[model samples]
Target chain A: MSAAPPVIDRLRARIGTPGPPTTAVVEAGHLKAFAEAIGDSYPRWLTEAPPTFLVALAPVTAHLPEAEEYGKGWLNGGNRFEYLEPVKVGDAITAIGKLVDVYEKTGSSGNLLFIIFETEYFNRHGRTVARLRGTAIRR
Target chain B: MNIEPGHELPDLIKHPTTRQLVQYAGAQGDFYEIHYDQEFARSVGLPGVILHGLLKAAFLGQLVTDWLGERGTLKSFEVSYRGIDVPGRPYRCRGRVTSVVGGRAELEVWGEDPEGNRTTVGTAVVELTA
Candidate 1:
């Protein structure tokens, strides 16, 4: 097989892209595990549930072929989330993602590709639950 | 009980390891090779196994929840992944109250490596109600 091209270049070329929305039924086990993993014993998170836990559902939002293609080169740069409402167990959630931008910058380490993706989470009633903006870097 | 502005949360220390990375991947369903396999990670140009961004974010959530006790709820959180957190390194998660308005408290939070490098920086808004 031929050598693969620079992963950053391939991802940059795919900038301004938007992926499809993904939907999943929230289960109590998922929530409990997330709470346990983080050491969060908050009754709200444990009992009533926490809104920020919605992030645990991110991977279910739209498949990114590049994510599979790039592998470890892709780094989670950061994420910003706005919670409009709380998430309860058994709620069917839908999340949509869009690649908002891609750019290159020279850093102390070298050059980096900054990929920005935005995701919106909605509840069963179609009410907006949370909005997440994320940045991933590849060097 | 209400948390006043400037109330601080106890710091949480995490010793990241290959084991934790593996567990995080399995729990979160993130099968990203960089999180586990060292060879795949190096092929991608990473120094070694690195912690997941969500895992670090989860650490921040833990910091907040630990402080808020059992009655609190995390309303929202935002974070910027600043640097790589290699396994086998020690990290500490900390939060400080930044604002309290309308019975809601906002905190500026971050995780730092043993060498004092800020790996993740973010803010969390939490509501305390019993």
Candidate 2:
């Protein structure tokens, strides 16, 4: 009945290593669109990024081709954001992410695979602006 | 900002539609079908298209910022999406000051479905101006 190695083990093998760093410059138009999408029209958002704007800059979860075979669907378990500086329009930011941990949990419905990952955001000055931790689940 | 331990932030209620979900999917660059494509979402075992967890986080973020105004800055904000939420229902975001010490304050935040279930629960920390 066993066919291949569990995806969790395959994913676990790459822990601590970060993927390529993605760099993007915050733009006023993007910020305005984001604010409008979320329906938050506070005038402040015209120049400054809102709290969850960082995720818009970079993906919260890394794309794992193997993990897709494990579950029929993906669910977002949660997210944590730490802001070290105010992200404003026109700031060039770079993000580097890595898989922190991977494990399997038995739930009421079925066995769920949990993938934990984190990303660090840095500004053009090389200063850390924020950190994000996320939990992506498959069942 | 009269942020006592029991201070309650004014709640923010959001009525998210499928159009907004599509908009968010584009804005966040998350083209995950579960959030936008109904057929694809169903194929993936979802009930239908669902709201992005980050969108709910944005709703909660607005809840905090709308209350704090210029009084403080958010240091850290976290949330765990405990249940699934569709786009048609109203999402109510609420939070209360859990603790206040000196220039720092902590609050518990959650987004409730129409049934009053706290589907998304989390916490946030803010540093107040002197």
Candidate 3:
């Protein structure tokens, strides 16, 4: 199956589309679990979540529902993260995701559609913590 | 550690188990079946249950953060998922200082499979205080 034209139209129609900002409280347990899962023994993770932890706030692929129309199989193209401030354990964080761009490119395997999404994390006091830009490929 | 250009950072070797993938799935709220279900992964043309690209990216982040130590701060990081890394295989995260100007240091980081392929490649900028 090829990339759906309707999906492309829907994506272009909503460029810079913003997602409902989601908020989650950073807890010590969650940090520990993540560190442990990655076998990271850094004590700092106990206090501050890992740099890439912000992506967990709202995974790029699942952040937008319109994306589901692309295809069933999904792959991560890449991610860029800018950390503004440390994410403390007791901090209340708000995550906002937006659809940045969409396009298709023909790969050696055939055709692949790329979707780019950007997510910003802010603390309860409105302090920016981190910003993430991710790309997902649908085949 | 001296924050200077041309310095090589220590390599971080990681062996992500299936159980760890499950834990990561739980912690990150990413229940993507391809990351934890071998059947689904194979059905989709993958060799097996591959580790999350974000997870592999995290490993690269750790490589820099661990090198920066306590006072150093991670300012910006980026990575491109070029290849798929299967579970149970050992992956090495390596990086080197590309340049240091003022208190800001830049690094080139990437993850390599057992075969020495650069599976994930990225650049990171860090703020360091001497």
Q: Cα miss at A28, model 2 (Å)?
A: 0.8
Local accuracy of candidate 3 as per-residue lDDT tens digits, A1-139? 8865787778877778677888988889888888887778899899888987776656555355676766668999999999888888988999888878999889898778898888888888898889889898987
Q: Give candidate 2 misplaced runs (Cα > 4 Å).
A: A1-4
Kindly provide the TM-score obtained by chain B of candidate 2 when compared with the true chain B.
0.97
* Per-residue lDDT of model 2, residues A1-139, tens digit only: 8787879989999888999999999999999999999999999999999999999998778879899989788899999999999999999999999999999999998999999999999999999999999999988
Interface RMSD of 2: 0.6
CAPRI level of candidate 1: medium
Give me the runs in candidate 1 sitting further than 4 Å from their true place: A1-18, A41-52, A58-72, B70-73, B127-130
How do the residues A97-138 of candidate 1 rate in per-residue lDDT, one tens digit apiece?
877776778878677777787888888889998888888776
Q: Per-residue lDDT for B1-130 in model 3, tens only?
A: 5778889999999998898899989888899899889999999888989999989998999898887888678999999999999888999999999999999999999999999999999999999866
**Candidate 3 share of real interface contacts:** 0.92
1 versus 2: better DockQ goes to: 2
Worst 10 residues of 2 chain A by lDDT: A1-10
Q: How does chain B score by TM in each prediction?
A: 0.92, 0.97, 0.96
Q: Is the docking of candidate 3 incorrect, acceptable, medium or high quality?
A: high
Q: Return the candidate ranking by lDDT, descending.
A: 2, 3, 1
Ranking, DockQ, top scorer first: 2, 3, 1
